[model samples]
Target: MRAMAYETYGGTEVLRETRLPLPKVAPGEVLVKVRCAGVNPVDWKIMAGGLDSLMDVVHPVVPSWDVSGTVERLGIDVPEFAVGDEVMAYARKDYVHGGTCAEYVSVPVRALAAKPASLNWAQAAGLPLAGLTAYQLLTRLGTTADDTVLVHGAAGGVGSLGVQLARAQGARVIGTASPRNHDRLRGFGCEPVTYGDGLTERVRALAPDGVTVVADFVGGVLDTTLAVLAEGGRHASIADHTVLGAGGQWMWVRPDSEDLSTLGRLADQGRLTVDVAAMFPLSELAAAFTLSQEGHASGKIVIEV
Candidate 1:
């Protein structure tokens, strides 16, 4: 199989297209023929050793956790899916080794979910990680119709989904983004507020009393989150761990087939959607990584296999 991998942690320059033997499928897992892989900031960050202390690295690491593909074969004891079933997963394992940026990947049954039929390959590929992040954060915060929610970095991959999910739950959403993306957020049924200078005031103008929930995807905005959060309101941050010290949850998305399936149901029901910013061939994964690192993309970047 041809894969984009790196033998050492460094930069996108280290990624090389090379041939590798087929990944061995463990019990309760399935070997998926990759159709597309989603590019997240964590992919490049892992390449740059951002998770060195938290995860053990194996040489020749394949670097993507988001996958949308078809099950080619099932491992022992797997009874949930059949061959040729279209599926997707946030395929993050306990260690950094095999990943989705390849022709094939082995994903556990616990992480696998039927892909949303309404989404194209690119959109399906992009949904797992970012969608799960948004879903888990909103669900954990117990978001409801009466709440006014604030989303930081609302135009980016995860934030964009968070905006939609919050809106789907009937919450009034105020999303932070640049002027260019404000209209995009509005289309998702969110009120857009420009971030940066006076972000708190802008959010406050919309919520008046204060936002009932805050979901921060782009971090570095704890001050604004605190300023606009209503008393006794809830908040969580995926990017900033310091939120733990601020009476807010610092969350990391997990791979749960049930949660992923919920997202798939929402997509199929037309209550959720994924925006793909760009697509690159599998061999051009380095370019995709660079784009994710640059951090300007308003939607998910994907590698089409």
Candidate 2:
């Protein structure tokens, strides 16, 4: 199978297209013929050894966790899906290896969900990791209709979904982004606020009583988050671990079939949508990684296999 991989931790310069044997399917796993792979900031982060302490890296690592594909084969005891079923997964394993950037990837059955019919291959591929991160954060914070939710980095992949999911819960949503993305947030019924320089004042103008919940997708915003949060409010961050020291949850997204399925249903019901910022062919994985590292994309980046 043709794939792009890096044998050592480095930047896009280390990524090269190479031929690799098809991944072996373990019990309770399924081999998926990759249709599209979603590229997240974490993909590039992992490529550069950003997660060296948290995950073990295997040589020649293929570096994406989000996949939308069809089942080419199933392993023993996997009764949940049939061969040929279109699926999407947050395919992270205990170790860092055998990712979705290849022609084929072996995903554990526990991480698989049927792809949403309303989405194209690119959108489907984009949904799993970012969607699930937003969903889990909102769900864990117990956002309710009466709550006013503030989302940091609202124009980026995970933050975009976080705003939508919070809005879906009937919460009044406030999101932080650049002026260019303010109009985009408004389309999702979110009140837009500039993220830097007097961010607290801007958010306060919208919710004088302070926000009832804060979801931080961008790091280095804890001071602003704490300043605008209402008394007794809940908060969490996927980027900043120091939130843990301030009585906030520091979260990591997990692969759950049920959660991914709920995201699919939301997409089908028109309550959620994926915006794809760019798409690259399999051999151009390095270009995709470079784009993600640039940190300017307003939506998910995808690799079409």
lDDT of 1 at 39: 95
lDDT of 1 by residue, 1-305 (tens): 99999999899889999999999999999999999999999999999999999999898899999999999999999999999999999999999999999999999999999999999989999999999999999999999999999999999999999999999999999999999998899899999988889988888888889999999999899999999999999999999999999999999999999999999999999999999999999999988888888899999999999
Cα RMSD for candidates in order: 0.6, 0.7
Off by over 4 Å in 2: none
- The ten-residue window of minimal lDDT in model 1 covers 199-208
lDDT of 1: 0.95
